[model samples]
Target: MAEQFNFSSPPFDLLRAAERERLSEALSVGYYAAGETLIAAGSAVPCLFVVLKGVIEERGEDGKLFAQYTSDDIFDIRGLFSGSSKHVYCAVEESITYELPASVFHQLCGANPDFGRFFQADLAAKRQLARRDGQNLAEFILTRIAREHLLPAIEVSAGLALGDAARLQLSRGADALLVRQDGELGIVTRTDLMTAHFRDGRSEAEPIGPLAHGPLACVELGDFLFDAMILMTRKRIERVAVREDGEVVGLLHLTQVLSLFSTHSHVLAMRIARAESEEELRGAAETLHTLIATLCGNGIRLRFIMQLVSALNEQLLERLFELLVPPALRSRCCLLVMGSEGRGEQLLKTDQDNALILAEDLPVEQGLALMQRFSEALLSFGYPPCPGGVMASQPAWCKPLAAWQRELNQTQLEGQPEQLMRMSILADASPVAGNRQLYEGLRQGLLRFAQEGERWLPDMAAAALQFDTPLTILGNLKTREEHLDIKRGGIFPLVHGCRVLALREGLEERGTLARLGALKARGVLDEGLADNLAESFELFLQLRLQQQLGGARDGREHGLDVARLSRHERDLLRFGLHAVKKFKQSLAWQFHLESR
Candidate 1:
């Protein structure tokens, strides 16, 4: 027996002093030559193996390779539970493994719940644990909920005169007053009172009940503050009621939510909404970089940051469209945002990707001029023009609804690379503003196109497999190159793979995570793999964002320096790349890519 286990790594890293001692003392190094089978499928459980040298391959009952274990890689932890092997573990070469007795492992698991949970959980949960290992405070700060930031709602009776209600709201310094009427709750804002008095010819003496809006949009008190923020943004409201155990307890306003992070995102969002001209919009858009930096520095989670940035970008684009597009033509067309922006996964200001869909053919040369000016205006606002010219200004992207459908159908008939790329990009396209029907019409046609073609998916799926995972799982978790192009090597594969899966399943979700969840629900993708891929994709985004925030002024990076990361960060990167590999392999198997 020797002290061979590295307590510095994950799972072991989660254990305390005494727990580490127990593991260190029980660790025994054993040598196995090449082609040695340590455990066969259905065999009784043996000691857990932690590879210290060489490589080991995990193959399923069908003898298909599943995973590889290399230096510092642990395997067969499932033996701690069922006490039997479900896969064949064979040494790929002469290797040394730290054999921890099953009984000792169980004792250590019981001694450290966090350590135990990591081994017991699925890939998703395991990755989450690995990320939260030494970052408890950061996690808590980034995941604050509505309950922690509630503003005690000032409730006013419905019978109270509108004038008294308005005065009460002013005296209490509340932006909105809740009115309880007939076992229902309603909300009245200052604007509501003013509009009623001026526009409806009603005096302030009227009952507050008639002025108040009922069945208010609400979020659970325990809901994450980011989720509450999304609710208010989507509903176009200033505040939301917070409910606790089926009863309204408090309210969450825009200002209070924005206060969680000392950023000017709210102010910027308002400015975009109220902008009357392109110049005014450009002035507001200039502050976007500062807001992104502020939010990132405040330790906001990557998901929340992407969502908030996406929402603000949408508001900006919509406002610009309103100012530029004629009122007469606005009802005749739909504006769509495609690619990362459409997916709501973009963090920094990347290139512009948008399109316009008209309802029918109409003579409007002036409208076309405005559409062409859209891209130039966006470039002036600091968003770089799309390299491939996917902007709405291009005639290829700006077309009628029927023309868009025809192009998609033509892409299927003739497998052109550019057309395929457009389809892939269009898969993530979503309407930011305008006629929702036009967007739906295009989506339904695309869905039908996907449903009709069966063998064609393998060709569409080939693009997802174009890139290789950068980290080496067969060796020590090391990068293949000095600098890793994480976006292409990691993010693209995960995103495109998930997109192909969604198309095959006919899922309407445009976001990668949302599609993964939908695919998992339909049993089209394994739950563990789905969750792992999601967390891994997010890990890539987080890594890229960190790199971008540090430098990557263009939002496109030269590469990610793996050597610059901490031990924990480096480990997460390796683990995430492995998730991408698993997902890519699954896609290959599903599409029968090998046979092709």
Candidate 2:
């Protein structure tokens, strides 16, 4: 029976022989009678069960069966790692199964690098699925935050000296301070203290009052980690002083929130939310580059960070829309972000591509006023006005729901390059705020339109295939004398390629990596080839981020020359560019485009 099992597919495909053997042996066959409880709900979990030959069902707290499992299905692994007994698994049939004990699973995976990679890939796939399904399970989302939760009440009073506060912060080694002031939990950071004292010429004895920020925007401990994340971003602070009855009890630092996701995410959301003015947003925007740099330096997962940051950006723009648009019109219409922003893959901030879809037949004057307000608000929020003016402010983009469908239908019929180009941008649009149903309709309509006119998708693919990968004659990466625009030669190809694949597959995933994986999963892109393409996209993003950060560190406005990249960077860039070349070839074949 064990011999009949195939561990050939990813992530098991990456596992070393010894590691696979260890895992296989540890996966002992277990049998359960029908109606038997296999794993209890709300108990400390010990192992994950892979249903090999039986049916297992999960019942949620509502006592409603939520999930059904069959052969080759995996479940409860995240729970085992979380040490949470929150899921109940019961046998729906008298069945034989593979039970991988959490301890043995951890031991084997930890002891073997290949095993770790195998598990990581499997887990990442599961998470991507959960996200697409909108599961909203905290354990599914927070799996990457590996830090042990800190102890309670590491506090500092509001008026503590900067020197003393700095000492306390150093002693704690935590990135934040919780100040109990005005019946609210205010937070001040060591960075805040440092910036104020050293950069702003504030005195250490100047009464930490000047340094402390907040009137804590609160979140219940029982709330989703995303709740804490949202509050932190909304309040524009690094540390959120966790309060119980208005007294500081614990602290949630931005670093902790990021640790819950990954490193590159630490400041991404906060930076966007804290931009009180457009100038600040411009400065904060550059930090995205630094974030990329630091994440690359530490080898943090890049895909998750991209999703996380892009999600925050959407939220930020949504919030800005909510604040700026009049209550009535805001409710009557949806704000949609198109182009790369819509695709959930934007790295550097670029021209805003947005549109409005309003409830059918509203007063034209009111509708136009709302769009104008939203556009101005976004411009003030640091998104430059679109050069093409394909914004809500434009009558062409500000439309009723039926009108949008008509435009999309027209574009599909004509297959106009100009129209296709515009539709491609519109295709990427996601609802930033307002009437979400309108955006949902937009998504559904676009998906239907793309599917019905599938032949036109290859044309879009051909356009994406136009960007040549920067591979040199000796198979090295060619860099410009000034600086390589990774955006043009590398990132754009991946982004556009993914968009083409998304349109072809009717997959709604907006990120480049996600589209690549989804396409690969559907056998639209080969597995190894997809992985290589993803790696190149990640490396390109990482390098661009690093260059941006280096510029910021030097207090410069522009990025660095990719041609003069350091030795390690040069090698990595070459490797990534080669991968991009291969990815471009794949695109060419997919579209039947002749290579130049």
Candidate 3:
């Protein structure tokens, strides 16, 4: 019997030698006839059921089929801890199942903490575990360059004597050292050092400036480890600088990549970071959907995928800004990305939401050419234009820092409904390049104004409840026009609700998940609600991304294509919407919008 049962299967496989022996000895096989209820609603869950044959159907009290378990699929583990089942589990056909008694299952869970957490973990954790369910090695999608060890970057002033630079490089024990001049970054390698003296015949006392290579090749820290190897091979360079937030932070050597992975060229971040021209950046941006599909298909979690995409987008936008904006004006203004892009939740190349902030009283004439080209370049890259005119090209969004602060303060103080929409959009603004200090000063002032405004929160929060959820009377999803507009129903309410709560509590975080965590930490929200909201938010992102990628090539708008989803998917969608409804209800109570 021990040999017949798949001890190698998950959950069972997680059991060790002693635990396996205990499980094998205690395991018993049971049979159920078709149409017979295995577990009744509200009944105490008896034991774990791992199907050996036939199908099992799980239905709610309304008799709506929520799921079907067949083959090796397990049913209702959470029912044990909760002590009662909320759904009826009935055999769809005659079945044979491996039953592990409640006591033995509990013992195994206690013995293996990893196995325990698999059931107790949050939705994200469960997704990760499920991705690794039967696997030995982690999925390739999780192999990020940032997780790999990066060699520290050594830097020397451009005017440093060749001998001094060489000594500095040697002291740091690096193959190369970075050189900075006039806000430009370049690299001077040890081999280049020898080439300078021997090939160019320059004295050791000469400055290393002329020997430095301009526009050094780069890859962002969030890039795939697999892509980094491809970049090294294609460029024929031994290493590439790693960028974070538009700044070079470390080095990724070919030797390091060689030890980790072989060549594969789906390198969006690497291509964007190493791009020399606007055309090159455009080519890189075109591959964004392919990369998203690859990562999502490989079982990478949605939030992690969003983080990687956001970092890559930032690197691309920063390089594009450097190309169009003149050197003289670069330090006097800050380039911003707002809305979904700023929130770090954007999964696909959507509408352009951006703005610019100039230093106080600084002339915009120096970079006026920049304002339109930035938007045009993005449009050329397949990013749709913001119909609401939220882009930097709009004069209303592009303003001086003092002007921005004053407008934000006036909006908050006046408490106008029309103005609150602008306030909400800016709540998630983030600076990706130029002098970030300009944006920082503007943001700090905005937060101060919101904190003091008495009616700001309720008015803003009231907007979250304006759209009713797309759930039926029995808490099932109700679709409109053959599909559900998940954005209006689930995504917006969760995002804006979390934003208002975060602001009311004075949290500076921008991402919804980050805000939810902060709110929980500050005791504004309980752990259960926080986890539920986070899980639900991620679920919406995953669903939205799934449909977006499916329609990318066809240029169709994205949503949960209700007519095409599987029963399990539909149930998951319902579960996620319920969580969203719960969150919105809480917001209504907290912000005193219950009457409205």
Query: If the candidates were sorted by their lDDT against the true structure, best first, what order would they fall in?
Result: 1, 3, 2
Which pairs clash inside model 1?
none
The reply for model 1, stretches above 4 Å from the true place, is: 1-112, 115-123, 130-186, 194-201, 205-215, 234-236, 243-250, 276-280, 361-368, 409-418, 471-481
Better of 1 and 2 by TM-score: 1
Task: Put down candidate 1 lDDT per residue, 380-468, tens digits, no spaces.
Answer: 98788888988887888888888888998888788677877888889889898777788988988789778776457788898888877
Q: What is the Cα-based TM-score of model 2? A: 0.55
lDDT of 2 by residue, 1-596 (tens): 66655666434555667877877787777889999988888887767676778888887777776667666666786676677857688898898887778888777767766545444443224223212222223342443222234334567677788888878877877577777777666667667888987799877776676566665565545444655665555445555545556555566666656655554453666566666654565565556555555544544445645655676677567656755666777767888888767877665566778888888857656677867866776565456788888888888888888888887888778888887888788767888788898877777778887678777777787776665666655354556675666767777777888888888777888777788889989998888778767777776766666666555432122333765564335545665666667777887887777653
Q: What TM-score, to 2 decimals, does candidate 1 have?
A: 0.76
**What is the lDDT, from 0 to 100, of the residue 533 in candidate 2?**
76
TM-score for candidate 3, please give it.
0.70
Model 2 pairs whose backbones collide: 42-85, 43-85, 343-510
Which stretch of 10 consecutive residues in model 2 shows the poorest summed lDDT? 126-135
C-alpha lDDT of all candidate models, in order = 0.79, 0.67, 0.78
Tens digits of per-residue lDDT, candidate 3, 256-342, equal 765543222324556776788899999988777776787666665677667767777787889899888878888989999998889
